[model samples]
Target: MSPYYVSYKSDGTLVSGPGSITAIGNQTGASSYNNRTSGYLWCPTARDFTVGSGGNKGTTADLATRTASICYMRGLKERVEIQTSSGAPWQWRRICFRFRGNIYGASGQNSQSGNYQTHIETSNGYRRLLLQFTDTSPAGNQVENALTALIFRGLPGTDDWYDYMNAPLDPTRIDVCYDKTSTISSGNTSGKVFRKNFWMPMNKNLVYDDDEAGGTESSTYYSMHGKQGMGDYYVIDFFKAGLGTTSSDVLVFEPQSTLYWHEK
Candidate 1:
């Protein structure tokens, strides 16, 4: 049994399965035009997301900054056609990453914090996906910023799972961890501390750890097999919120895929 499950509807009653609904386009709200054309939607507001800045330290108030990171795990079975506004069709899949952790920067010395962030390739082939993290202080002199560890496939539209595999030593358990520490001080005053940890799962059997230096690393192969199953269609797992510490939070994105017309 998969540790994660995909559910539709607000009640979490419409559990998805192998031979479930495959078509997209449906009414998501009472308003006629409010119909949802996306194949699926999963919003994980229940989980707290955070991003780390760097290491832990302080004095001049410019210690380390706070940044947000994302971790994603996906199980795919088939391939779906990704269409663009120019009427271009390409093969693609949706990989969702669920995040849970603290948003605000850690306090005091020797403190740590972390969050999870996920990404996927749109039909258009644009690789960079911009995500927002929380603001430090509205009226403070502290320097703050956000960071994330991105894992992806280098060879786009390829079908080899081994290249993208992060084979975990243990076949039964797979774990990913990211930690950041911040230190701040003037020209020899004192130092403060800030730190954070973020983690998620890559299937046990499909685990592959390339152990590259930077976070913006991409795998050369696919982690899971691409067979004819439920994985071939559009899939929505959960929705993640930004790291804004206040109500002025906003999640922005430019739609990359062209909308398709489905005959109900």
Candidate 2:
């Protein structure tokens, strides 16, 4: 019997399937893939929803709102396994996620600018990866306080967020890969979509080796095996709290928004 399954609610209806590569990637082609190391997450466009204004400035909406869109990936606790140098077995807990989405003003404006963020919760809601907008000073004296902050946090048996910025690896320094604006036809109007893409740097310090008894603890290791949990299925929340008052001025999650990851 198959051991893995993924489930999520779409338009108040529950949908589920085996956690196989074909299923997870929503592939419509072959029965299987030769490369099982990577696949696309099965986030349906029907599951796509919007967040209104008046949310917390730098965070998502309340837990009740987040829980409504929660997705579950069972049998992921041990999807990837490895062995330490001491012959002890270990599950390499790393899977990188690539998020592709768009930002646009919900109002009928031809242009849009806003503070947007993507929040990913995993480990049964104990761990979080927050991809905030980056506030940078650009040319022409432009300021971007509207930009969000990228951060990682965990719940160490408490209700508070345990910051991971001070860690030696510095996982909080996430960078964007692509961002551009283009015009597209939306029904009868020529609408625009601001496409933004993000992928974590592979140079992160997620792997540690204590092979030498007295060697200095080093943190310069990189590998696909060291990627974090995209396999566990993530409850991803997109929030837009722009500095505007128009109810039409909102962030839109495009139907093409996707999560790509490598598995063991």
Candidate 3:
């Protein structure tokens, strides 16, 4: 069986698939990804479930996941070449993800430290990766406080929300190879060919948080805003928080994760 990670509900029920890339499953009170094959993902678009611990879609939302057993992708850095004869062609696109280690879930309470982000800056003589959002600022590096914070509703704020600037596990960094062709003898150019490379460390457990507005601080509902912090965009203390404090404590068990993709 393919190695994988598994997430659970606060009740300790099966949440994500550690063996199969099922569809994003749903939890009544938390931000857990429901492992169904077809349906509305937590992010609102059609969920793109897969077989292994990875999916092919590039959009955020349920597309990203975490489990204690995130090692499914350990030692895997191969470029996910856009399949030429993929039965699902439209699913091909630029994508990237990374796995974190020793980390735990985040809490909305006191979320502002031990975090890091970087981007590329253009105005500088040499292009280099800086903090996230800033990587594209100055024509490259940027401080995307906007992206730093996210009030993710079921459908871009259409339904109840699980988080509001609750630091969800974000990629430490992302790199993309866009508008290219796949590496194959019979090159298929019907769609765009892109590749995303990710780097992850097994040391730091990038903990994220959610401060539920309803005062229901269930582990299952971790980082979720309960529906009160709606329409309010938080200025994510970008490049912040993860001090291993009482609140920033990473989960004791393994944090599960999957290399998700959109396969349409």
**Model 1 agreement with the true structure over 1-264: per-residue lDDT tens digits:** 213322211221122221122122221111112211112322221111111122232112221110111213333222221111211111112233322222122331111111122222222211212221212221231211211112232221235222111211221211223212211122122221212221222232322222244864433112222321111111131112211111121111122221111111
In candidate 2, the residue pairs with backbone N, CA or C atoms under 3 Å apart (3 or more residues apart, or in different chains) clash, namely 94-227, 94-228, 95-227, 95-228, 106-248, 106-250, 107-248, 132-148, 133-148
Instruction: Go through the candidates in order and give each one's C-alpha lDDT.
Output: 0.21, 0.21, 0.21
Cα-based TM-score, every candidate = 0.18, 0.21, 0.20
Residues 1-264 of candidate 2 have per-residue lDDT tens digits of 111122221210111122111111122111111111111112111111122233321113322122122222222121111111121111111222322222112331211122222222222321112222222121221111111121133332245432111212213433232222222122322323333333322222212211233653312111112243221122232221212112222122222223221212
Ranking 1 against 2 by lDDT, winner: 2
Q: Cα lDDT of model 3 overall?
A: 0.21
- Model 1 scores what on Cα lDDT? 0.21
Candidate 2: residue 51 lDDT (0-100): 26
Error of 1 at 126 (Å): 26
TM-score winner between candidates 1 and 3 = 3
Segments of candidate 1 deviating more than 4 angstroms: 1-4, 7-81, 87-144, 148-201, 204-264
Across 1-264, the per-residue lDDT of candidate 3 in tens digits comes to 233322211111222221111111221111112211111111100111222223332222332333221112232122222222221122111122221111112432222222221211122111111111222122221122223222121322325432222323333321111112222212242323344443322221222232234754212111222222111111111111112112211111111222222211
